[model samples]
Structure formats: C-alpha cells, structure tokens
Target: MSALPYPPPPELGWYDEDATVMPQQTAETQPAANAQPVASAGTTTAANPPTTAEIAQTTAQPTTASQDDDDIDWEGTVLSTAFTASAPKQEYELYNEQTGQRIIVDTGVLLGRKPSQDLPQGVKAVKLDDPTRTISRNHAAISFDKDGLLWIEDYDSLNGTYIIRDNTETKVEHERMRLQAPCTIRIGDQFFTFEQR
Candidate 1:
C-alpha cells in the first residue's frame, strides 16, 4: 500500500510566537488555554483542496518572460515570406526543433515606413523622423522562436529588410530572409536587431 502523505507543518504544533494560531494547533500546543487532545489523522477531515483540473491549469499557463528565456536554449534560422503594399508585413519565424516554441517576428510592428518602398533606407524614411514614432509602435524588431530560429520581418512599410551578420550590413531584396543561427536581421531605417530564439 502507498504510504500516507506527510502532514503539513500547520497540522502539527509548530507556531510563530508573534502570529495567531489555528484552532487545530491550539488544542495540542497550548496547554494554558485548557485545549483538548489533538485529533488523529483518521479522525481529522481535510478541508476543500484545489481540484486536479485547477492544479493542471495553473501549471499549464504560459511561461513568464524570464522563465521562457531561461528554460529554452533557443537557436535556429529565420525565414520571411510576407510583404504587401498596403500592409507590407513579413513574418520572421524560427525552427529550432528542440524546445518547440514558435517565436514569430513581424515587420509591421518592428519598422514603420510608407507603403510604397519595399526596403526604404535612411533614418527619416523609416518614420524615425517623428520622435513620437519611436515611442509609438513603429520601431524595428528582431526576435527568436521556440525552435531557436531568428527572424527579421518588415513592418508593412516602405523600408525593406537589413542584415548584420558577423558585423557586416546587407540588404534583403527578397521578401524572405533565410538566416542561420546567431544572425541579426534589421528592417527599415530603425534597423531592428534579433538573435536566434
């Protein structure tokens, strides 16, 4: 037969002098109060506890930023195949095949540019001219996925893609960027940077 679980410390006589005591502990630990005998394990009843589903739900919740960053090794390549005139956004996805966290990097949110040019160069062309744009939501981006691949997608703007692999700058004329591990992709004038996720 399975052994009985250990009783919680609260069920015992242990107590902090400064704090109030529970009714169960008072009888066993406080003789001055004229307490009665403590109930045995079979005689005592456990109050409502967390349901199995509730416990599973809490544990299944998405990992926090710190936890996710710490848990995954995160290394892979980036591939982009998205661009349009009105919303010229590209998707930067990684394929690590290890942790299996699909990290997505989009351009529309990363770099802010006009809907005309595919790869608009210069700081001003990327909407960085307006100070508010930076604070707004038009900044360039570089992110990794669960698989550990890096991504650099355009943010549906005039400016195109930029790459800084091994400290060298290169333009991505194609809509997609097939990059290996530990590569950085910059989009628009802001030149967002991202590592393998």
Candidate 2:
C-alpha cells in the first residue's frame, strides 16, 4: 500500500510548462546611467539586469501545489478526534512543514474560517451504543500514534460512527477505529477531514 495519511501530489497545471521561458529585457527599461550597480560577493556588470518577471518570480508567494514531495502545508497537517458520549469543544494544533511553525485551531469557532459547508438534513454522526446521544456529542481525543496512525475511538454514542473514503461511507460500530492520514470521519451530523503535513 502507499504511504498513509498523505495525498499524492497534484498533477501539473497548464501554466507550469508555459511559464518556463526566459523573459526579455531592453535598454529603455534599464536603470538610469548614473545609478551604481549594487556590488555583491563578486564583480558585477549591467549585461544582466534583473527583469520584472525575475523579481516577481523571486518574490512571489510559492503556490502550495508547487511544493516538493517532502514539503507540507497547513492543510496537509490536519489532525482530529471524535467523541460519542461527551461533546467537548473540538481543538486542533497543527504544524506547517513549509514554515516550520505551529497553528492552533478550535473547532467550535472553526465555522468562521474558510471552506464552510452546511450540515445535511437527516444525516448525523453519533457514537455507537449511546441511544440518548444527539448529533452534538461527537468528541474525540486526537494524537498521532507511534506508527503515525491516527486513533479515533468512539466515546460511546447512539447512532455509531461513520468514516468516508473517496466519497464512499463506512459505519463504525465498535470501540475505536485506527485512522490513517488523509481520511474523513463523521460524527452525528458534523464532518471532520484530516490530511498529512
């Protein structure tokens, strides 16, 4: 099997191949004759003044899809846990491999963030064996397992747990499920998605 908790790199977009051409420069666009070329570690000449395209390329924000195989963005670092009996506020703390930084997330207020969606009617996620449970009690303790596996245990709910893969859904009617990276889990009506960092 392929590596768990990781999505394959996106296919190259059309712009990639077309944008590799060398940009042009002209004397009219060059700096005034009186300006001194900044000196660096070595001798310099005006034969190759940087172009706007070059500067834009140097200073441009790197696209997430352009990342190397080993690089990861915030979306790739998603981690989550689900609950059945108790509904504690959901929380997430993720690392950005590209930036080497940490990010904190609170699920309760997460709706204010981007990528919002409305819950579907009559579709709810719940803990297994908890009849009194409502769609609200989905709580989980999320941490990366030693093997890099994600362990999501049902705290005990009525309707049980459901996991979604490739748009196909599977119900969890047991104590817990060992989640791999880049999987989606649903508790009651709420949905949570995670990916590798």
Candidate 3:
C-alpha cells in the first residue's frame, strides 16, 4: 500500500512544457523571446515605452482655467487673513499732556533718554532733556504684554511716578501698573497720556 494519497499528486514541471495543463501557444500569443512585448492602445509597457509624440499628445490636452481655480482653498485663505487681522497689534500712541507732543510706541519698551550702547536692543530710548530735571535718564517705561494690556513701570526715579484718574493721583514706585487709556501718567513734572488706536 502507498503511504501517500491520490498518487502523491502529479509531479511539478516547467509551465511552458506542461502541455496537459497549459494551452499550446499560438502565433498571436507567442513572440520571439528577444522581441519586446507590444503595448495595447492607450497603454504603457516596460518594453514598449511611450514615444515623445505620445507624451506630447497626452500633455497637449486642454484644461479649463476655472477647473484649475476650483482646486484653490479660498475659504482657508480668507480665514487665515481674518485670524491675522484680528490679533491685537503692538502699537500705541503716547501724548505728552504738558507739551502737546506725540510719540508712537512700536518697540517692546520705550525709555526717556536716547538709547546708549549699555542699553539692550528693542528698547526705544528718547531724549526728553527735561529742563525741570524732574525726569530721570530712564525715568519710566511703557510696554504691552501678550494679552495686549498696557503696562507702565517706574525705574526707581528720584522724583516718582504717578497715575492720575478722574482728578485723583496714585503713586507707582518700583512696581508696574496696568495703564488705562485717556488718563494722565505723571513721570515727575512731565505728564503724558497713553492711548491705543
């Protein structure tokens, strides 16, 4: 008795020579082994690669401009612009209530005297040259925080800093204070108004 079932299955052989399983090759099906395989219409094959003419023909197909425009994300562009515009700009105007002078605050902070090599960058130092000698070289500083709140700090000046609201005066010494617009900021004898446009 055989140990294997079903005559141990038919012996495997090369497919080309397996006539009982594979159909005989016809002239249409078989080409010379060295010959490149032919490509069908509108198809590409490794051996029969596309010609320049065929490539040009495919690329020459006309495309509508409107169809190209439809691919753009206009809504996203508009939303991004609106988000950028909605962000609070770091811009303020400082009006000298005493002299009717105005200065734009665009930098991070502003000092009373002209900037020197010893001072750090991003601090806009201005020369006030106060004849009263009440203002210090760096009397006070004005800046805006990330939340767009305006802040004023006294640099421990000799005379002192004051914020007057509704005809009342509040002293601000070494500490910082949140500045509200349309109010008076008295740095020594000189008074200024902080405003946002």
In order of listing, the candidates' clash counts read 22, 15, 0
lDDT per residue, candidate 2, 1-197, as tens digits? 98678876665454555456555658877788899877674334587777787677667857555655335555576565432233433444433343333433332211111212343442223222223243334443343333334455554555445778888887765665765656666655445555544
Give per-residue CA lDDT, model 1, range 97-165, as digits (tens).
Answer: 322333444432233433234443321222333332322234344444444344444444455556777
Off by over 4 Å in 1: 1-156
lDDT of each: 0.45, 0.48, 0.72
Report the candidate with higher TM-score, 2 versus 3: 3
For candidate 3, which ten residues in a row score worst on lDDT? Answer: 11-20
TM-score of 1: 0.26
Q: What's each prediction's TM-score?
A: 0.26, 0.31, 0.51
**For model 3, which pairs clash?**
none
Better of 1 and 3 by TM-score: 3
Error of 1 at 3 (Å): 69
Which numbered prediction scores highest in TM-score against the true structure? 3
Worst 10 residues of 2 by lDDT: 107-116
Ranking by lDDT: 3, 2, 1
